[model samples]
Target: MVKSVAAPQAKGKSAEDKIFGANNRAVALSEKLGADKVINGTVGSMLDEDGNLIMLDVVQKAYKALTPKEIVAYAPIQGYPDYLEAAIDQCFGESRPEGYIRACATSGGSGVLHHVIHNYSEWGDEVLTSDWHWGAYGSMCNDNGRKLREFELLTPDGHFNMESFKANVSDMVAKQYNTVIIMNSPANNPTGYGLSDSEWDEVLAFLKDVVKGKDKNIIFVSDVAYLDYSGEKHECRKFFKKFGNMPDNVLIVVAYTCSKGFTMYGQRMGAMICVTPNKDIADEFVAINQYTSRATWSNSNSAAMKVMANICKDPAKVAELDAERAKYFHLIQERADLFMKEADECGLKYLRYISGFFITIPMEGSQKVCDELEKENIFLVPLGKGIRLAVCSVSKKKIHGLAAKIKSTLDAVGAKQ
Candidate 1:
């Protein structure tokens, strides 16, 4: 027998991350067959029309302008005072909710998820999210000794399934009394669906009713990593105003990231902000999350924090950044439009794609479909229920004829959509 010293929980842990696996395969094929003949859509990062990664010019300039000290120094465990305010401002925009708000730096949007899971939930507790969610949510919960429960994201008619959501929340609250829900919207990963303003109202109203007389705590985490690329700037954020005046037991945590918005992917800069009707809760959010930061990552990237602080402080810089991002936004939109149009014509079934980096095709045998597509030099992420196409990285040229090919593959495999 082999000797081992790993803890039970840590033993036999290996990551076979399908996303990276697919990307690696695509790269190997590209090297053999040449890049021009391959359609690589595995990663969720913006790419130019020529298949080169896009880093916003304005953000690049800002980083290049940073002093050596700014790049090398350690940021505060919580964050710089100005960067915290900038995070709140960037997250809320004009739809600032009426609440006692506070923020702390994080590694990225993923770090925000980690801190929320650690701080808001009890060990062995069940956390809630939509069924068609980013896969990392499950990993994070499992790593922290929490179970993840999911509600159906869409009804058969392609609308938000409030019934499923309410039922799931009720079940979770009954079991744990303290429920933590993570909602990724405005550009949900794997699927581009976003809840409407009315849907937002319904969700908040239902939650308000759930905790009416019961002594319960609800922590709602809005993972807005793709908010900047979702749609019209202020229009996409209008739902945030509804967070105001929420029940004291209902706390709102906004996970904001500069990855997509500022094209700062590798910089690993983001913040987790709390909004509460009670000032005490807001203060406690800062204290606890800051302490968690120290215990975990220690601090975030100082240069990235300073870049955001500088950008947020100047109106001109903000305008320039927005303008530059809009160009790529429209570029991605055009690519999505091309694929969606072709999908419609070819009878390709996909999740309701409003706007975002990825579009998921709901199917029974996604891994098989993706495997077949890979043979044709087309690589995509295979989720449990479907294949995710990263329109953010695929240019319009490559997007052409892509949906029809996928539909044909599904048909060949007799996969149900």
Candidate 2:
């Protein structure tokens, strides 16, 4: 008798299931928030008058310009050569880190993260990162049967805790598992903190010691998702140069996404860059990454890649785009500053935010507080640990109401105690 071999029940939840599950957290919270005017900080997009995303203008123009023939064809599995070259040049700029490196296009930054976890790390391997991080890190690792380990992020003085970081690295090394450390910086999400040159030196030194003469591999992945939002562009770009000089045991992978920078969220175009000490390692990393990509999403959107490449290649267009983006970036800063000022006036302490879309405010029972805020038509993410306010999406006119709502929630919670 021929036995039917049904596909192995998929491990964990399918990607679609996971995404919807994650989103339901916000949806549930929103529903509880009631009929109040909702200022949705959880959403990542900028909306128009009709509540549709405003940033689609850039993408629609790019799409209309493409030839019908181009739209109908398949992009190379590795991605268009021109798109790859343009993306690499735009990211690395003139410095072009002095190593043999290659880039592969992926569905988005999230896809790149999943590919790295599956391709490079073994099952049950541990990924190290700060305690405060984008929530998706845990989801990605868990779905793949990998453990997510964290180190305390702040010192007593409220700076990047180097000692704690090094100790965490040592603990992971002693366990003898291949480790991947993801640092999201320049303009980090949630807390909005960036590492200084000194802190970077400390991290590199610790990694050097951990991997010294040990045949085991260590991967340092940088998620530069909010790179363009930083006020100091030159300083932010300088950090990429450090990756060029790391040892061979250290593989530097940069996941750069156009979603946030170009306001191309729906396009889902992003690059997975692997930089190695020499040509051979670079070639191998590229091959493995491409294999992972093929096994997963195949290749990313061809039309989006072409548009990004064209815009990046034209200097005049690039300048115009940067100028336009700067207006929104500054608006984010202005709104954040206003909120911070009001938070101070109300004695509502929050984590220091240099530059980024969100700020985390500490409060007991954050989920409860978030629910209450929703009743007032003020919506934000309840992070369990704290409340994450997306300053970028909330209009300047809405800042005062947000501040008042947050302060009242905190006060009520404190009084109950």
- Flag clash pairs in model 2: none
Give the per-residue lDDT of model 2 (tens digit) for 25-141.
Answer: 545754676423456666655543233455735555777798875666789888899888877776666556778779999877887788788877789888888887888888899
Residue-by-residue lDDT tens digits, candidate 1, 1-417: 667798998777668888888998888888988988999999889989988889888788888889999889987899999999999999999999998989999999999999999999999999999999999999999999999999999998788999999999988888786899999998999788899999999999998888888889899999999999988888998999999999899999999999989989988999998889998999899999999999998988999999999888999999998898778878888999899899999999888888889999889999899989988999999898999999999989999999999999999988889
**TM-score for each model:** 0.98, 0.90
Reference-based lDDT, each prediction: 0.91, 0.76
* True-vs-predicted CA distance for residue 272, candidate 2, Å: 0.6
Q: Provide the global lDDT of candidate 1 against the true structure.
A: 0.91
Superposition error at 149 for model 2 (Å):
0.9
Q: Among all windows of ten consecutive residues in candidate 2, which has the lowest summed lDDT?
A: 14-23
